[model samples]
Target: MDQLLSTDMDLSSAETDQRIHDLSGQKQSGLAWVKANVKEINDWVDRDGFALLRGLNIVSTNQFSTILETIFGEQLSQYIYRSSPRTALRNNIYTTTEYHADQVILQHNENAYSNCWPMRMGFFCVVPAKTGGDTPLADSREVYKQLPEALRNRFEERGIMYVRNYGDIDLPWQEVFQTQSRDDVEAYCWKNDIQCEWFNDGRLQTRQFRPAVMTHPQTGEKVWFNQAHLFHCSAVDTEMPDSIGADYLPRNAYYGDGGEIAKQDIDVINQVYRDLTFSYPWQRNDILLLDNMLYTHGRQAYTGTRKVLVGMAKAAR
Candidate 1:
């Protein structure tokens, strides 16, 4: 941590609204500091699951993008096939999640249900809530080792199948795909090996199979890398409305061979995530970088306003 803060930069949290496009001049200090410790940050995140770099003077979403792009040495990845509602604040930055303060987002690896996902993700806290809003983290490696051998064997063999229903209850197809045209959505599905079914009633469904565990490209370690619990019907079965059919529940997971994953299995996954999770309260201008596969994250229900910007980086297939 001292190596990261070796350079002399403004340690105070100066919240400014002006967007920073150029990293030269006054912005160069932060960029240079990040450049100096780039390897350390990556090394730490690879050794552990994540690294929290506190005390940075980030002004706007553009500045957050600039610092993260510097560390990544490339442009940030767009949040495609998004499952949650997030308003884009800049070209590559968006609000973490627009869910109400009382809604607790379930723990899951970012985009783990999809074939392609960002290897790294950064979260910048612009505003901290008055009460409780913490991004809890869990080590997926431990999750993998602690799960039952029989259950792991089943998932390793069958993989995981994710089915998403779009229209009501869940996100609409247009929002999920970031397009209004059906043709565009179909083309994307075909390219990504996702099976899409369009109903005459204006609803859309997609099914894709992805592995439940993956070996980290950098660490050569296996991690429990799927979102079965978050996507299962058991996650929201109690709050579901009577009018909506159970089959139409927003998203669900099953065995790769088209068999249902029992609710008990989902319960077990959730319990393990809860037991392994750890969190810290947000301080404004704090930046968090996480290895998306090695760690899983979730939001806790809060009281007042909370604002956090997210950038996904280092795309991996």
Candidate 2:
């Protein structure tokens, strides 16, 4: 086990390479070192919400899966209600968001818009991008504290409603549910508290109401946790032409009562994320472990190829 490093400690005066924990030396000891130090690692993550484990020399998806299993002590969670494309490398190991390298992914907790979500997640960087592509991490606790009192109160009171219209242009219902059978998808939706409807045109629509804030099961700390900004109409408006109406967008979010979320509020939330996010360039074989309820993660646009593998564990409601 290596010494735990605090991200809050001023690193401006220290050499850049000395800032993060380098656990490469522990490779010789293998999982034994991780097993012995699991408590320390968990405590660090609980305090910081995220930890960067660098230089483990993890080469393949199989190795990544093994390492994650050792840490999580269980099988990884299946990615249900997918928003981005990803290919499963093995049973649970997956390539992180298969979007274009030039696309910027906004910060959000994994599956925050859904009824159930993973309690923790890990990202293994196998290949570093030519430039940019740093995964930004933001403390959800800070996001909650920084949010305006009125907006936070309103969101906590009403919760959030996510609506999706699945079709060819966006992710199809089959792909999103990871099942070709409509009955299976419907069953999943029903079990997950999602309302599903089918259209005559072979389209599928679903609506779900989820909390905007959640108390961490282990720590019992309230954190801002929702994908309102990512699913808002303003997000679609920024990418698509003006001809597309908000209602016709692939996905959108509103208050739990189906009331509109103002664009200004969304902008404020985004700005707060930008102000609070902490980011670092990915180093090959660097692994990031996150307390999903306490932290949010996002991808920055890059110029070249970047391969980051991801896995999640400990599903919680």
Candidate 3:
């Protein structure tokens, strides 16, 4: 694991040479060397929002977890209040996402839709796809700068309200909340400011209003930080059947007051993401670290097996 095979997504290329650090060398020097450069590596990620670490021996999930904990100085935080399907390999490291091979997972700041989110995240590409299975990234600060002033103003004024229904087409209530007790679910929701309603048919509906933009505590920079585009009817309809009414959809986003956002607005937001998002082919054994608030990550559709593991920490409210 001494030499690095450059991938476009590595971000260690000429323009971003500082973003990649070579950790492969003598057998005994790798992890110790990383400890010495912690501040520098973190600085690179802080300045650029993400960085690629080359030549690491991250061959297993536990090894990945150890590296992440060693760098961040904390055990990986549990993926509580989960939104997507993922299998826990061990040590809180998880499969990034379990969506179908051909379905594209939209870019999102980890747990951004919730009141609490992981501030730091790390990803390891244990298995690269045959062709297109890159974990593309976007700088949220750039996203904020590129968005139209009017659109920003509207979102700022209204915030973002996410309405999620659980039962049939998506995750069940127990899985989303990670518990079976209704009382426990209510207690969790009460603590998180999420309004949860239970139906007789064993379904649950939840609504929460979160700010569309967030100020990074460390950077003092504002970022586009909500998942409105991913939850809008237009995007959901792309995968869901047209016959499914918007009301019955698994999730949807609206203005804070619950007013419908104009379709054109969602289109513009999605288009901006299209213009800004990018990825290089993933190479096996590549590790990527991100300042979650400063960046958003997405997955590409691929034909073969693609395995990426995640370790998230630095919880912030």
How high is each candidate's TM-score? 0.88, 0.91, 0.92
lDDT of 3 by residue, 1-317 (tens): 01111122344363457666666663654456566777887788877878888776654677778778888889999997887889877889889889887777877898888999999999998889987778878889888989999999899889999999997687888888889899999999999999999888787889999999999998898999999887777676464646777777898899999899987998788767767787756777878999999988888878888888999998999
Better of 1 and 2 by TM-score: 2
| By TM-score: ranked, best first | 3, 2, 1
- 2 against 3, candidate with superior TM-score: 3
- Cα lDDT tens digits for candidate 1, 86-140: 8887768989978777778877889999989998999999999998778887789
Report lDDT (CA) for all predictions. 0.80, 0.81, 0.81
Evaluate model 1: give its TM-score.
Answer: 0.88
Which residue runs of candidate 3 sit more than 4 Å off their true CA positions? 1-16, 238-242
Q: Which pairs of residues clash in candidate 1, taking residues 3 or more apart in a chain or in different chains?
A: none
lDDT measured at residue 249 in model 3 versus the true structure, 0 to 100: 84
* Runs in model 2 lying further than 4 Å from the true structure: 1-19, 27-32, 238-244
Least well predicted 10-residue stretch by lDDT in candidate 3: 1-10
